[model samples]
Target: MNVGIETGPVRTGGYASSPERSGLAKFVSDTSAVFVREILLLLRDPMTLIFSLLQPLVFLALFGPLLTGALGQGSTAETLQWFVPGVIVMISLFGTSMTGSNLLYELMTGSYERILATPLSRSSLLVGRALKEFAPLVVQGLLIVVLCVPFGFILHPLHLLAGLVVLGIFGIGVGALSCALALAAQNREWLFWTVQQTVLFPLLILSGMMLPLDTGPGWMRTVALFNPLTYIVDLERALLGGSFTDPDVLQGVAAAVATCAVGLVVGIRRTRRTA
Candidate 1:
């Protein structure tokens, strides 16, 4: 009865109203802003966007039809379906490699040093840069799907989602690796092209991207087994209704994980060293 006299409306403010979670909110806000800025920068580069989008289309148009004839009847549809994943993988690889050029550009202009001067975490800088590549890769992957629709390729939405996941993972892994390499590059400008050609051409040819591994010799098959890109392309193939063995899918997942692990370690070390 005596306690009833003290009852009143309680007013809570400051920490009681909105409690801080864990780490610095300022860091989260700043990193988010940086991510948005990077995405905008990528959007403004029309030529880069166009070239990135068109390269796969051109390859699809030229090589897609050629492989159809090479592989025999009904192979056109099969080959295009096969090429869908390969194109996504190729685009991811190409798109990620461009990170080197972007970083190099920043370095040349002293912008990178300025970024390093900020209170940003090195990991955030690395991740933010990689996030910049994700949107374009997704766009390119969707474009490939659209282009394939007219060619009689029907994709289940679930499978498409799975394929996109694979592409996203591939993009991140490749982008991280490329960023690390770019940091170590003495001449990032010229080395960008060199890395693209050297790393991509073989992966494209051997990963069953353009043709089946059965078309290759024994050594090439062995090489394909070890190539991380092979797993990416094969995973896409499996999702697209091509005949992919269980072992193939498992191998691919393992390879992609390994590549990603290696890339993460390298990217983290490189960022710390260079920053």
Candidate 2:
């Protein structure tokens, strides 16, 4: 009766069966999952995406021609070279600024709270949402640029890609901040709307995304100095114009990075509190 050592490999639970992911790896995985979820949601709403793009295209088609005369750049191509960057920035601004509203809607439906109940990282919720904005932004920007090409906009592949990268970074910050605002105004929807509208137009005008700040009144020029978007717009124009070595490029990069840092800090902290 040799009931000899019948010890088979001991069974282990899930955690012991697999090595735990490192902190950074876990974060990356969580963020990627959230990003994919957001993108899938976005894809389901094709009409919203189409409508979101219409305003920018209308601006290019109607306002673009007017800008040629206004800037007196001597050619439609030259004018577009200058105006296109601003329009793309405009898309980034408008597109990301309202991201909070989506979060707010989710809150109303209790989906946001349900998501927070999961084991997913809170910071990833905000970051992944912000990152999701980048795809539509890039697509809308590329389409706008392509349309402009027929109207004389020069296309430098590398420069265009780089400029979009910069815009995407800036947009992440804006989107994150928007998410934080959503968290703050979770109960007061009107507060979010009020604050968003109040802040957004000023940033747009002050950034000189639609007009040059060079000839603005003394006080306006001084005010523009405090607006980070001004530097980014200047940098975008410079990069798209093949002026990569321009001095303002450094400032723009710094501004984009700073915005991203601050927004992430605020957004992540707010998200954790919600959890």
Best by TM-score: 2
Q: Name the TM-score of candidate 2.
A: 0.91
RMSD of each: 8.0, 4.8
lDDT of 1 by residue, 236-257 (tens): 7777764345556666677667
Steric overlap count per candidate: 0, 0
Residue pair clashes in candidate 2: none
lDDT of 2 by residue, 1-275 (tens): 78776453332321111136558886887798789888999999877678778887888788878887888789888889998998999889888988999999999999887787666778889999999989998899899898888878888889888888988899999999999999999989999999999999999899988888788899999999899999999989988888789988889999998888888899999989877
Off by over 4 Å in 1: 1-31, 186-188, 242-247
Each candidate structure's TM-score, on Cα atoms with residue i matched to residue i, is 0.84, 0.91
lDDT of each: 0.73, 0.87
lDDT, residue 67, model 2: 83
Scored by lDDT, the top model is 2
Error of 2 at 112 (Å): 0.9
Residue range with the least summed lDDT across 10 consecutive positions in model 2: 9-18
